[model samples]
Target: MPETLNVQTRDDFGKGAARRIRAEHQIPAVLYGHGMDPLHLTLPGHETALAARNSNALLELVLPGGDSHLALIKEIQRHPLRRTLTHLDLIAVRRGEKVQVDIPVILVGEPTAPAIAVVDAQTLTIEVDALKVPESIEVDVEEKEEGYQLFAGDVKLPAGAELVTEAELLVVAVQLPRVDAELEAAIEENEAAGAELGADAEDSEGESTEESADEE
Candidate 1:
């Protein structure tokens, strides 16, 4: 679980103002929801970046009136080349309130045999208390035999957690190797073809040389 990040609101907006905010080591962010007006804000750039490094980060917004609000980091815009945070959107939340969010999926364990784990679903959307949202779910695939397909229903969630995703959805599948055998066969065929071509070239050169010698 990640700790709450502290943020302060900003009054400025737009492209040029956002650029200046970044140069001042603060990130531009917007907070909306609860049927209220959107509040523009600026967060400490370094702390914001570090907190977002982890998935499903919980943020604490400290408003000007000494009031603190809990929020979830919704969307983040970044510079394409520099990879710096350009803007962010935050959604306010209340404690013990269930919020819909997508948590990351982590695979664990190795499947026996040459099998591929096909992940049909990468994230699981669930309702959890705003203060207790999980960052990710760990899927144990260790020593699983081939042809073992794990579904969303098969995931073992942590305590106090509920699944909001459809149980029938395929989360992962350990199937028989799909490409190794074919790739090896193709390589062998290519090598055989090259050998035959080399032999043919040598034979052609020998015949030409013999013909020239006889003419001489």
Candidate 2:
């Protein structure tokens, strides 16, 4: 679901103007798309920040003049030190239209014993309905054995969703746990050999002393 909120339109521009907007606890934004000129906007910081948590947040933007538009939060720039939003970008969209979005990919269930599921792709690109974007896509790995794999094209998409990623791209990799036990074993064997060498050296010295005494 999407969120609906009223926002103030901004006529002011430039660095100083942007700084002033931030001082008021608002985020300066530019709305683009649908072949129209970009509109400058000032959004409430608290509400915008909350909505920005969702990567594909659909915004129902209401302007001061009572005009409204359906937009997607395209991009967000954050302040490095404060970790707050400095600017935002919005792209206008219409209902029933297809929009390209990168949705999070999640791995569910455990693979068979000695095998682990590793997600190679964090987010997957797909074209889905603008109004009905899915939260995330899940990949199942239960009872999967080593060498199991899931490619981007093989993933099941939501209804009406089309994969935009390369078909041959690997999405998940299931393989046996990588371990190195030979090195440790080799070190232990070397230590045992060293101990035997030391014992033999000590015994040789004792025998030499005994031979010297016997000659004396």
Instruction: List model 1 lDDT by residue over 86-145, tens digit each.
Output: 888888877778888898898887777677676779999887888888878999888887
Residue 49 of model 1: what lDDT? Answer: 92
RMSD of each: 2.7, 5.4
Write down the TM-score for model 2: 0.79
In angstroms, the error of model 2 at 113 is 4.1
User: What is the model-wide C-alpha lDDT for candidate 1?
Assistant: 0.84
| Model 1, residue pairs in steric clash | 10-41, 108-141, 109-142, 110-142, 110-143
State which candidate has the highest TM-score. Answer: 1
> Local distance difference test, per candidate?
0.84, 0.92
lDDT tens digits, residues 35-101, model 2?
9899999999899999988878999999988999999988989999988999999999998999999
